[model samples]
Target: MHDSTQSRRTARNSLLIMVCTLLSRLLGIIKARVLGSVFGATAIADVINFTFNIPNNFRKLFAEGAVNAALIPAFSSLLGRNEKHRCVRLFALLCTFQSLLLIPLVLVSYFYGDGLIAFLSDFDANQVRLGGRLLPFFMVYLATISLASIFNGVLQAHENFLHAYLSPLLFSICVIFGVWFLSDRYGAMSMAYSVLGGGLLQGSYSYLMVRRYEYRFKPMLRPQNAPFKEVLVAWALVSLGMGMQIITQMVSFLFASHLSEGSVTAFTNSTIFYQTPYGIFFNAISAVSLPLMSRAAASNNAPLLRTYTRNSLLSLLALLLPSSIILFFLSRESVSVVLQTGNYTLADATLTALVLRPYLVFMVFSAWYALMLRLGYSANRHALMTRIVFLQNLLDIALMWVFLKLGLDIVSLPLANGIAYTLGLFILFFLLRDLFPLTKEARFFKGLLRIVLANLPVLAFCIFYKNLGLQWHESGSSFANLAYLMLIGSAALGIMLLSYKIARIPLLSLLRSKKHGGNLQGDNLIHLD
Candidate 1:
């Protein structure tokens, strides 16, 4: 009975988290629009992007991917054991240690900002110098936000969803306000300070909310005998794996930096836009699956773990397959509607649309690989995950080089990403063959193939429709162009749905499935043990 109640609570918390994430994405679009209008696809935006990537990468390494991956499972286990005091102590230690560490990291990044920017940025002399100037301020921004992420993760693990959800909203508020008030007077540099101020506000906001939960912070290095050390070490190792998965991001960024003054900004904006659907589907699956996987592992229910893993994989494919198609067809319209504003001209929109078309192809593959990695981690197959990460990274770099050599240009980066993800998925399957029967594996692949085949008609129709839409009168208004494309695109999507029904594919299987509460209610899932 207690287990049933606990499961209900987890489900509720997961729902809250998902809602918050969706809100963040919405705010993210708004913020991007504001920045796009103000800065456009110019050198100033490029410098801001370059400066921001430094801390953003670090955050992914520690706060989002690494720390949260380690903390949630370990913390869940600790809490499962009823060791509440120890859990609180662990949070305090991390908060304290990170606070001290961030100070130095921020200082170093700021003081040596110019040199670092010059080294990392492959750009014209003027752009490089400007990027370097933006680095110190952005470094401060990254540092504070990264620290805030720690608290956010803590709140997430505790299943305190509200505070965690609001943190990013707070960030977006500060940024919009800062840009609105200061961008005019101080120009591009003021945006940097706005980012820093937003970061501070976000961090303080999270910290205060955390205090309300009775998790007080203290500054001490007492090796508090707990799983903190083990988890930290494990997280570091896992981050190496996660970091490798994105090795192509760094490579592509470096290569793109060499292209032109505005190339980096264009690429970054393209990435952000493409990431929206990825985040919606990928994050949704991972959020629900990880805790379930951890629970299954803790209870020693291998079969249930396998079942959950399979469901999560299918859910990802079901979403990504269609999303990739939509992205390919609507790339231009999406860019115009979401990003084309103010300083962002038609040319900038066209460029971003061009790059985004190929970038979303790996959505399904990467989502599946990410699920496999988490499943492996939950089952304590850390070594397997580590090796996969290493190989995936190696493959990414090799593919990036091949694409460049072949003159594939900007699209090659995502193409490399797609190749790596494809390889990773197969490797994960082979490694988990015992858990997933050979026949079942065949069925999964068949289902995925059917989904792709099912969407082909829709893709073809959209291609034809888009050509026609482009021909209909040339209105200089971005909105008019977008509306026409969307009208045509909607018709295409409608046809796609009809085709899915004719093909007898479960087109909305994911949506039809039980959502948050459904995972815990009126189901035999709990008895799978």
Candidate 2:
């Protein structure tokens, strides 16, 4: 009874987070459109995008709940034994240490950001100088976001998710406003200033949220405690895993830079399109699952852990499969409609869509890799996760290098990423096989087959949708492009609904879920817990 009730709460929280994430993702598109409209795919655009990518990558390791994942286990462990005061102190101490470490890092990046920019890209001296100057603003962004993550971690550990989820939305809003109002004068530099304000506001909001609790900001530095030691180790391991990704992305930037004048923008923007699907589905699942899975792991609750894992996997595929297909088919149209306005030309949008095709493949497998990676954190299998991640990252880098040597030109960037994600998904899945035990194989595959069947027709429709007298060709107007995509989307929706009906899938059971039922072995519809 208790477990079922908790599951209900979890579902509610996940839904709430999903809605919040959807808002943030939309706001992000606005930011992208604003930036793209102002600078198009020029060097200034590349420089701005690349500069943000630096601190953005750094911030992601902290932002995407690695801090929460690390801290949750420690907090869970301590609270399991009734040591609440220590949890508070440890939170304070960890925050103190994070700030201390961030200061010097920020100083270095701020002072020599141009040199760092030059080292990372093939930009000429002037563009390098421009990127360098902007790096300081984003570095400040890194600090603010990094600091915000600690508070987010604490709030999430307490299972207070609303404020933690809102920080990103708030940050995006600030960035959009700053860029819109200040851009004419500050130009690209306005983005930097906006980032500064956004980060500060984001950090402040989280701090205020945390203040409502008994957690302190006294700046304690007692790292020798056993609880603190466990947290430090967990955080270190998590950082190591994230560090591999950070390196992989930086190398990707290097490869993209050499490809062409605007390759960096295309490469990065294509990946940005990826955020739509991930945020709408996988992000919510992972956010809600991670802390729950951590608790389940700590208490050795195998049944509960199995349920979360299976449902999360089902939810992701059920959502991502069709979503990836539609985007894959409409890649050019999607990019064109979303970004090809103002200064951003159709040629630039076309280049980005081509880059997006491979990323769609990467994005699908990436969902699995990410979910399993969290499972690794839940199980505290950091060393194993570390190895798996590094292996994948190294393979990706090597493949990128080989592709360049093979004279594949710009294809090397996304091709290497796609291969790495495909291989990494298999590797992680194999390593985490115990979570999806063989006894459940019959049900898992059945549910998976049903999901596949439901999407097969949608895939077919996407393949030849333009052939049915749909005037989806270029019309030189953004409204026309958007309307065509909308029509296609509406038609696709009808196909999926009919397909679901034909498959006898219960569409509402998952949404109005009253209890956690079934698993990966369900016969028709996916049964969400």
Candidate 3:
């Protein structure tokens, strides 16, 4: 009964996070559309993308990836033991340490911004100068977001996911306002300033939310803080591992930089579209599952851990498979409607679609990889996770190098990423087999197979709809394109629903129950805990 209650809570929290994520992503898409319309795939676009990459990547490393991985599990463990004072002390230490650490880093980045930009991308003199000019503004985000990450960790430890996830919405709103009001006068630099604004707002909001949960910030650096020391050790391993993943993206940027004038923009734009659904569904599941899995691991509850992991995988596959199919069939049309306006041209959209196609092909593998990494963290397998990420990045870089050598150009980058992630997913599953024996779960596999098989009709309908020669972007009318997309999308969804009904899948019911605030039975849905 406790497990059932936890499962429902997980579901509820996951849904809340999903809604928040969806809104943030929607706003993000709007922001991207604004940028695309204003700048298209020009050198200005490339410069903006490249300049922001450094700070944004670091944000992922410190704020999102490593810090969260190391801090959340430890914080959750402390809270599980009812060690509120200790947790608060550790939180204060982390904020101070990260603040001191980031200040020097940001200072160096500001001073040597030009050299750093040149090293990351082989931009020409003008573009390099623009990047140097923009780097300092963007670098401020590193500090703001890093602090925000700590506050986020505190909120997640308390299971306050709504505010933690919703906080990003402020960032998007600020950027949109910047683009709308400031872009005309400041040009591309307006976006950089907007990033700083967004970061400040995001960090402030997260800090306030944490304080509401009784977490007061005190500046203290105690060397003997055992929990802080433990977090540092784990953080080092997690950062190194996750840092390599970010490096893979940096490598791709380098590769794209060497391509044509607009290649970097094309690559970045495609990535944004691909990550939208991924962020919405896969990330939401992982975020909500982490604290629960951490508690299970702390208590040495292997059964509970495995249950959470398996259910997350099942839910991911069920949702992501259909999303992948939809993206595959409509990559071009989707790109056309969303980004092919203003300064962005049909040619640019075509290039972006080419990149999105192969990226979406491996969406399921990417989702699996994310879930497995979270499980690794929950199980306190940071060393193993580090090794896996290192190997994955190594393989991806090698494949990318090979593709470039073969003269495959920009599309090769995403293809390499997809292949590498696929390899990593299989390897992770094999390593996790002992703790989470997926093959023995015949019912889970059966349902998964049904979900996959059930997607066939949806795929068929999409293909048929495409063959009907319906152009979503015809007549240069946004409404017509959106209407056409909805018509086809609704049909595809209906076919998927019908197929699931025939196959006795309970996804719709689970969603319905979740929507109606009804208790979900373990037997009715794949039990997650």
lDDT of each: 0.71, 0.77, 0.81
Lowest-sum lDDT 10-residue window in model 1 = 520-529
lDDT of 3 by residue, 104-192 (tens): 88788779988888888989998988999888888888798899989998899888888898888999999988878998899988888
Give the candidate order by descending TM-score. Answer: 3, 2, 1
TM-score of each: 0.78, 0.84, 0.85
Provide the lDDT at 336 for model 3.
84
TM-score-better candidate, 1 vs 2:
2
Worst 10 residues of 2 by lDDT: 507-516
Runs in model 1 deviating more than 4 A are 1-19, 32-50, 109-140, 184-189, 242-247, 254-270, 332-355, 406-409, 434-470, 473-477, 491-529
Question: Which candidate, 1 or 3, would have the higher TM-score against the true structure?
Answer: 3
Off by over 4 Å in 2: 1-7, 33-54, 61-65, 76-83, 106-138, 182-193, 223-226, 258-265, 341-351, 401-409, 438-440, 464-471, 501-529
Against the true structure, whose TM-score is highest? 3
TM-score of 3: 0.85
Candidate 1 matches the true fold with a TM-score of 0.78
Model 2 lDDT, residue 154, Cα? 73
